[model samples]
Target chain A: MMNRKILLHSRPQGLPTEDTFKFEEAPIQEPEEGQVLVKSIYLSVDPYMRGRMNDSKSYVPPYPLGEVITGGVVGEVIESRSDQFSKGDKVLGMLGWQLYNVADADKLQQVDENIAPLSAYLSVIGMTGLTAYFGLMDIGRPKAGETVVVSGAAGAVGSIVGQIAKIQGAHVVGIAGSDEKTDWLTKELGFDAAINYKTTPNMKEALEKACPNGVDIYFDNVGGDISDAVMTQLNDYARIPLCGAISSYNQEEGSDVGPRILTKLIKTRSMIKGFVLGDYADRLPEGAKMLGQWLAEGKLRYEETILEGFDRVPEAFLELFQGTNIGKMLVKVESTE
Target chain B: MMNRKILLHSRPQGLPTEDTFKFEEAPIQEPEEGQVLVKSIYLSVDPYMRGRMNDSKSYVPPYPLGEVITGGVVGEVIESRSDQFSKGDKVLGMLGWQLYNVADADKLQQVDENIAPLSAYLSVIGMTGLTAYFGLMDIGRPKAGETVVVSGAAGAVGSIVGQIAKIQGAHVVGIAGSDEKTDWLTKELGFDAAINYKTTPNMKEALEKACPNGVDIYFDNVGGDISDAVMTQLNDYARIPLCGAISSYNQEEGSDVGPRILTKLIKTRSMIKGFVLGDYADRLPEGAKMLGQWLAEGKLRYEETILEGFDRVPEAFLELFQGTNIGKMLVKVESTE
Candidate 1:
């Protein structure tokens, strides 16, 4: 069977273009002992993928040229050499930008289709959801009646963070790039207030108005002026959970260092914490169980901005840096049916 | 008796000048019910005093013009109308910048002269020492064998922080302004290494060489490029206890923003926490007990850069901004004997 894969042709300097990714076809490899051969269904295109494209010091090593671009995915097991999975068993694993992959059975998490859609496994019920859940609850530590301001509010992790904060009885304020995203946040996602950062004349003033009591917890997703503005209004003992910095990811080389709010931290007596999901690997199951329960009860809602076709993965990934997606940006590689 | 006090004449634009202060003399009024008259012996000159001088918002309100400058002080109770204290008792309280203060007796802590010295109440056994102790142990959370780096290393809070980290079995590295301070930190304070940032051409490289293993806990006293440099070399999950930002206190007017290290924070997955001593007021006795025992056992040591005479208080405070003081800066208001 033909196995289609998108490979990194060269490192991206800023915003990745279609030329940076090369799609190739090959025969699907057979699964070895203790491995499963799977056909990719939904491929997650996250902002963190930008870090992997560059050869630099980071939490994890960057993707090298001439290799298939790697990422998280939900897939259907086509062949299984181990007793852990059957041919039709659905699973979630790191399958990269590929239509098919040979993954170790140990690395793949078996998905229960009866509980939620397979696509939910790639967004709300997966790493994206867990990242938002743990970061807000653990680091942000939003208490009931406290104000929580989240940037990139329409994105995967941020949307969930706002909803989770709301469920926990916090006053949730969201900062999004567009009016439609802002509406979606307040009208659909149950956010208390939403600010269209692109249209807002003064984000600082808007944030002050939105959070009259002052922000007690800030779930920072876009780390630029919006984050800076939110930081200024934070109350004493405020918690800032650094989930992502998508705003500064695609800046041109030699761009001036963005606004610093560390001095503000001292005055406001706030705490800014940067965290990774892998760092909390030990607590993933606990996070998953809680998130699963929330999703099952319909208390948590999520939306997927899906890009059609496997060849569009690079474009879909680029949209994240440009703030073009409404929610979890996902690319549909192949039909499960 | 004539009561002498320093009044805030004008708000400081940058570095405070003599014009910002005005000396006033008034009659020492009789202590009212539930009040005691304290004759100031030692007045504490701290970095946070800079924040209190500005009209802008901060953790604490600014010292209003025409009002006595607020500060912590060790004083002798010359008269008391309350049952809390008797005549000739040594006490510590927020007495402002005054030769004599009619304060509520309940606010004062009876000082034990047997424990080291009376000045120790404002140094190693006082709020400064407690700040370093709790900030390091609770927020910084340095693990054994880890490298702990402290900025303003030879100063009041930083000096105690280094010694406490050393006592906790961590390799301590200190960053100071002068070679003499560096020598004192390494030779006298038992720090593993000390870097005089003035002589060190590359702070990142110096820290890398000293730490070998990236910094685990950074007790930040100076917030500027020094903090930025240390932040770049921090390990994953590194804890930074934000205490004071002395470096920016003397910046020229309109030069407000400091270095932007949010990106670095996200990259390293680190945490920066700002804490007020009042937040841990309940735990002060616990910290004091531990620090007191450490002092008695000679496990912790402290140095005071005493600027003699109450008239020299403004100059002594200004010297802190210039990085002139080696340790806790204090002004002798009156002789204890």
Candidate 2:
């Protein structure tokens, strides 16, 4: 049989383009001892991938050139040579963007599609869910009646965070790019309020009207001017969980200048903490358990923006920068049945 | 008795000038049923008071126009109407910039001059020492072998933070404005390294050379460009205890813009927290116990730039912005023989 894969062709100067990815084909390999030959079902494309394309030191190393792009993938074990994974089992792992993957059974975690769909593992119950869980619960520590303002409120992680904050009894406010997103957050997700950044001329005034008691916690995903606006409204002892800065990801380094935060920070006595899900690697089971319980109890809800076909992976990844996807952006590869 | 006090005549557009103060003389106040007549021996003029000069809201309300500026004062109780205070007792309280103050005995904290000196209560054993202790211990949480970088290293709180970090066996580096201050930090206070920021052309390069292990904790006292440089060298999981931003204290609001820290903060997974000593008001006794033990053990030392005479109060306060004082700046109002 034949397998198709995608590789990092070259690093883009600004926003990544079509030339950044290269297509390839190879003969499918058989599963070795203690391994499984898995057929890819769905792959995730996230904002953090932009940081890896650069040749700089971070929490994780930068991606190497001419290599299969590594990301979260949900697949089916077509052939298993290990006792851990049986044939036809659904599994999830940090695997490459390929049609088929031959990986060690130990590297893949068996996921159940019985509770939710196969794409749900890559969205609501996987890394995306865990990222929102730890960042908000551990860092934010929302109190009942306290105001929580989340940037990228309609996006995957932010959507989960707002729902969890609501479960904790916090008055949640969302900031998104479109009126549709704001309406969905307020009407469907039960957010206390929502602000459309594209339509609103003055966010500070809108925030003042929305958060009458002042912002107690800010879950930052799209940083820059949006973050600068939120910083001005922080109440005393406000907590900020810094997850991503997708707005400035394409701006390059040293040029993302804004108002210095030290003054307002000192004045309000606020704290802003930058974190990734990897920071809570040891507590993954705890987070996953809570997320599962919440989902089963119907206390939590999630959204997904899936693209069909493996070839549309690069296009789906590019759409993240344009704010075209509302939730977890996933690309479906093939059918297992 | 004639009492001399200064009033905030007018709010300066930027930095306070000679025209800001108005001197007046009134009869010394008599102690009421719950009050004590105290003679002010020494008064403190700190950088934090500058924030109060503006009409903006902060931790405390802005200093009222045409009113006496309140600050730390050490005085002698000449007359007592309350059972709490006795004659010849030394007490400390937040009192006006005046020679005599008639205050309620409940507001004054008794100090033992025999343990240290009269000025020591206003410096090491008073709010200055407590601010350093809590900001470093509670927020910074320095571990042994960690590299700690302190800006405004020779000032009141910065000097104390360095000594405390040294007691924890951390490698401490200080950034100050002059050779005299830097020499005092390294030669006297036992700092591992010190940088004269005014003479150093590139603070980032100097910091890199001084901190080869990268900065684990940054105790920021001076903000603006100096803080921007410190932000670049933070190691993974770095903790910054934001104490003060004396660099831009004189500049009016909204113009102190610099590089945004979100990207670097996310990359390094660091946390920066701004705090005031009031945040630990409930634990003042706990901090006082630790500071008193360190001082009695000879593990800590202090510096005070004492300007003689009550008339020099405003001059001493103005000198704070000029960076003329190496440590705690004080004005001697009177001597009790």
Candidate 3:
């Protein structure tokens, strides 16, 4: 059978265009010893992947040109050469933008479809969930009645973060790019307040009015003007968990020089911490159990915007920068049926 | 008796000039109930006092226009009406910029002239030393053999910070504006290396050479381009204790927008914590005992740049911006003998 894959054609200086990616077809390779041939069901497209596109120093290495762009993928184990996995078993692993992949058996996590849908493994119970769990609970450490502001509040990681902060009894305020996203955050996700940053003429004033008691913890996903506004209202000993700076991910390097917000940190005796999900790899099991329990109890809610067909993967990724996705952005690599 | 006081004549638009302060003489009042008549001996001229000069919100309130500017002062009690203090007792308290004043006895800390010098009460064993100890130990949290960088390394708080980091078993690197200060840091204070930021053609390169191992802890007393340089060399999980930002203290309020260094912080998974010594007031005795023991064991060294007269207090305060002092800067308000 033929396998279709997408490759990085060239690195973009700023916002990636249609020409930045290339699609090609090849014959599917057979699984070797201790490996499994998997058919991709769902592929995740996230903002963090933008960092790996740059040929510079970052937490993750740059994606090599002329190779299949890799990310979180949920697939069905159609052919297995190992004793650990059986045919027809659904699994989750870091695969690629391809219709099928030959993955190492050890690297794939078996997904129990009866427990939850296969796409849940790519989101709320996976990387995004664990990130929100550790960063907010550990770094943000929001206390009861304290105001917690989450930027990119309607996005995957932030939507979960606001809910978790609410679970911890914090007064959750969210900042999203659109009114619809903000409404969803407040109405559906249980956020106490949500600001449409795009519609607001004065963000600082809007933030001040929303967080009347001042912000105690800031879960920053978009780190430009929104962060600057949040910073102006931080109370003494406030904590800022720097998860992502999606605002500048597509901009040319050095184009965005944010205001000198560090002074506010000094004045208020606050703390700003930058962290990634991989840092808490050891605690993933515990985090997954807690998140799973929360989901099972209906205490958490999630949404996914899935694009149909394998060829739409690049378009789904581009939509992330456009603020077009309501929640987790995913590409359906193949039909489950 | 007569009292000669320094008053805040006008609020400084940018940097304080001769017009910013006014000297006047007033009648010395009697010590009523629960009060003492004190003769100021040594008054501290600290960088933090600059914040108090502006009519803005801060940890300390702004110096009232047409009123005496107040700060940490060590003095001798000439008269007392309270049981807590007696006549001729040496005391340390937050007194005004005056030669003689009536201060509340309960607010004064009795200083023992026999243990260390009276000026030490305003410095090494007092505010400056405590600031260094807590900010470095609690916030910086340098582990053994890790590289620690202290900016404004020649000044009051920065000098003590570098020494404390060394005592904590870290490889200390000092960044000072002058070569003389750098020499003092490396040659006398036992610093592993010192950078003369002024003469260094490329500060980032110089820092890289000085700290071969990436900086694990940064004791930031000066924030500006110097701090920007230090940030680039931070190791993963690096900790920065934000103390003072002397570089921009004198600049026009809106002119100094520091580079968005927070991005580097995210990339490194580092933390920057801003704190004041008052936060650790309850733990002062423990910190003082350790500092005193270190000083007695000759493990700690200190320097004091004492300006001779009370009238030189403003000049001494201005010298902080000029980077003149080698260590603790103080104004001798009255002679001890």
> Best candidate per lDDT, number?
2
User: Model 1 chain B, TM?
Assistant: 0.97
Q: For model 3, how does the per-residue alpha-carbon lDDT over B1-337 read when each residue is reduced to its tens digit?
A: 6899999999887778999999999999899999999999999999988888888767778889999999999999999999998888999999999999898888999999999999998888999999999999999887889999999888878888888888889999999988899999999999999999889999989989999998999999988888888988999899999998888787655466655766677888999999999999899998899889998899888899999788898899888888888889999975445
Instruction: Tell me the tens digit of each residue's lDDT in model 1 across B1-337.
Output: 6988999999888889989999999999899999999999899999898888888778889898899998899999999999999999999998889889999999999998987799899999999999999999999887899999999999989999999999999999999999999999999999999999999999989999999998999999888788878977888889999998787776642265544567667778999998878879889999999999999999998999888887888998889988899888999985344
- lDDT (10s digit) by residue, model 1, range A1-337: 6988889998877788877889899888888999999888889999888877888777878898999988898989998999999999999998778988999999999998899988898889798999998999999888899999998899999999999999999999999999999999999999999999899999989998999999999998878778778877889889998988877676542253644556678787889999888878999999999999998899998999988888778788878887889989998875334
Native contacts kept, each candidate: 0.63, 0.86, 0.62
- Superposed on the true interface residues, model 3 gives a C-alpha RMSD in angstroms of 1.6
Candidate 3 lDDT over A270-290, as tens digits, reads 999999999998999999999
**Residue runs of model 3 more than 4 Å from their true location after superposition:** A335-337, B252-255, B335-337
- Evaluate every candidate with DockQ and list the scores: 0.59, 0.87, 0.64
**After superposition, candidate 2 runs with Cα above 4 Å error:** A335-337, B335-337
Error of 2 at B221 (Å): 0.7
Writing each residue's lDDT as its tens digit, candidate 2 over B230-332 gives 9999999999999999988888777889999999999999999999999999999998898889999999989999998888899999999888898798888
TM-score against native, each model: 0.97, 0.98, 0.96
Interface RMSD to the true structure, each candidate = 2.3, 0.7, 1.6
Sort by TM-score, top down from the best: 2, 1, 3
Clashing pairs in 3: none
**lDDT (Cα) of model 1:** 0.88
Cα TM-score of candidate 2: 0.98
How many Å off is the CA of B322 in candidate 2?
0.9
